[model samples]
Target: MTISCNPKLIACHDCDLLQSLPDGEQRRGKACCARCGAVLHRYSRDSIDRSLALALTGLVLFLVSNLLPFLALNAQGRIQDSSLLSSSLILWQEGNTFLGMLVFATTFLFPLSSLLAILYLLLPLRLGQRPRFSIHVFRYLQSTEPWGMLEIFMLATLVAVVKLGDIATVIAGPAMYAFALLILVLAALSASLDPQLIWRRLDPRCNH
Candidate 1:
């Protein structure tokens, strides 16, 4: 889960003991619970810049993935192409509205919005300016992070390509590669983003 929150007393999920983190920020390290000794938080330098670069790249790849042909099929010498958006729309046209909406929300809507939201919050901060509703938007992002289910979408697409290959000539499209890279970018963005670090930058009075 990716988030940017101001937390003073973090409760250990395993033991439910609320505790404070240690003083001094390092380039890379994890704070652990004193009782159960579980990992509390991780701190790293240049997290904002790293996350910003990855998010910007992700937004570009996401647009490419949705615009270009996602995949193509050649059956009986008849060629057909489909984009990521088309796939979801096809599901809707085929009376699978629920699944279509789910795919659209999880794959297209959630991921795009997440990247945009990150940019919205981070860009101003990067320029040494505080964005409007910093805390509110940051907190809201945390709720929507889990809904970006691109990994699941990728897994399903892989299975589909394999199964379809047995019948049709599955031609991987440019968007397919873009989508693959987009997934990796988003994954790295999540890991590189440090919630605590952002909280400190956003609010100096944090944990004070």
Candidate 2:
């Protein structure tokens, strides 16, 4: 763990109140706005190595989720399977252009972008080297985190499977499991990630 020797002052995003951190060693915690009780930010000392591992794993699962079959629908003894990209293409071909684009963006593109961005930002930091555009990439992650809807997509998939089971046999494909695991990995990545550690590595003077 990196040692922080001095206290720092930060402005609350909620109330715009400036507050000082306790004088001494820094530790894992959540800072809240004194006036509004809104959460200002969080601090933690989680390992960088673990985050890198999760990023790599999520990337692999993402690939498998896209390349392999996601689901197989068997109706009247006819089996039809679809991969992630193919599903989007099918939707586009069927003239659901807007929804196709939405699914592609939220489920595939945004999620992949997030994983790649994580690797890009964390890989160099893990090697004890400073990465270019570190601040921009980190800010991008913060801004775009809500855009990636892996969990929402997974829930929709489960609902579709359950509903389709009454009329047709829905075989859970390899990609389904991979995507599910990818969701879990990404969630773990988000939780295990230490904002304090990332900012500390990115900038020595950074306090939040």
Candidate 3:
């Protein structure tokens, strides 16, 4: 029942001296090493509120990323553009069903599920109620997070754009950059968030 991989309440990163943190811990505000002034945990001031806003923003961006065309390429006076979902469908139509399904699940499903899970976990915590689906949401987020392929998708798109530039005129779509930034932000959000914090806020009785 390890709630965190980081066990030391306060530790000097340079010297490796672990100090036991005093509770209240300034209401879980911040813990610093007394010996070296190294920060251990800097608690977020408005975790629930900020997480909720980010989750909602992520949802909207996820929708836009799937709905709008990613990019347009014009070759020999013929133009082609595709949304994220459309690209998957195109792959399937071209007899690459496995790759299509992989792309769809990685680029769309996993990331969206992660965002929704964060929302599900945080929303109820904000209202001072235990989240009913806390465990399910945590499991969903943890399982789906690794499958998010937005960064890989961006890299692939870049390679395609560079290679296609020799044969066609390439125009980037609004959704393309937005989607990339969205992925980056979501990744940051996921990394910054602590499940223990959310769980504690949700259910104080749960063993950490």
Candidate 4:
């Protein structure tokens, strides 16, 4: 059957083949492209609700990760604790302005913006109200999603701890755990979000 030019229609990213989405019942199974076997889309169960919950949880964890001590170092009878924001400021104060700003943007600003954007879009929809500029906002979220570098930052933190372990005692802080959890939560939030479903809900023209 021919697929209508509706929201339910999708183009395969791999082969650029256009295809219609299966019905709700057929969607319960895997939906693959007929020409290339590339997966088109899988209906995310409770896409909106799951994304909303994950985004809220991610926001809380993001706050905790930035506000609390990320790690503590003890050497020569002196202890130093560093939070995420403090680390960025320290970098800036050390004259590494570009690096500092990059760290702050990738680690702090982008991630926070992503979470907030998710909430901003999903909250109104959850309440049965359409948000203004939602299409633009959602596009912004998609574009900036790649810039969130929490997982990379976490890896760098662990490496720093390892390299410093030879000369000092490294103690994991509450924020470290929270940061780790935030990474996972943000990943889940991204996965749970269905852009097609969101766009369809936001624009009634998709239904026609």
- lDDT, candidate 4, equals 0.85
Better of 3 and 4 by TM-score: 4
TM-score of every candidate? 0.87, 0.85, 0.75, 0.89
Error of 2 at 157 (Å): 0.7
Candidate 3 lDDT: 0.74
Tens digit per residue, CA lDDT, model 2, 39-77: 665554545778889999999999999889999999999
Report the Cα RMSD per candidate.
4.3, 4.2, 5.3, 2.6
Compare candidates 2 and 4 on lDDT and give the better one: 4
**What TM-score does prediction 1 earn?**
0.87
Quick one: ranking by TM-score, best first? Answer: 4, 1, 2, 3
Which residue pairs collide, candidate 4?
none
Question: Candidate 2, clashing residue pairs?
Answer: none
Return the TM-score for candidate 3, rounded to 2 decimals.
0.75
Q: Where does candidate 4 stray beyond 4 Å? A: 1-4, 24-39, 204-208
**What number of backbone clashes does candidate 1 have, counting pairs of residues 3 or more apart or in separate chains?**
0
lDDT for residue 72 in candidate 1, whole number 0-100: 95
In candidate 3, which residue pairs get closer than 3 Å at backbone N, Cα or C atoms, i.e. clash? none
List, residue by residue over 1-208, the lDDT tens digit for candidate 4: 4345455688888998877777753355457998999867666788899999999999999898888888899998899988888878899999999999998899889989988999999999998888899888898998998898989988898899999999999999999899999889977877778887787787755432
User: Across residues 1-208, which tens digit of lDDT does each residue of candidate 3 receive?
Assistant: 3534334353566678867655532465566777777765556646667678878888888888777778998988999887777778888889999999998888878877788888877777777666776777787787667798888888898998899899899988888878887877776676457654664565545443
Q: Model-by-model lDDT, in order?
A: 0.85, 0.81, 0.74, 0.85
After TM-score superposition, what is the CA distance of residue 7 in candidate 1 from its true location, in Å? 6.8
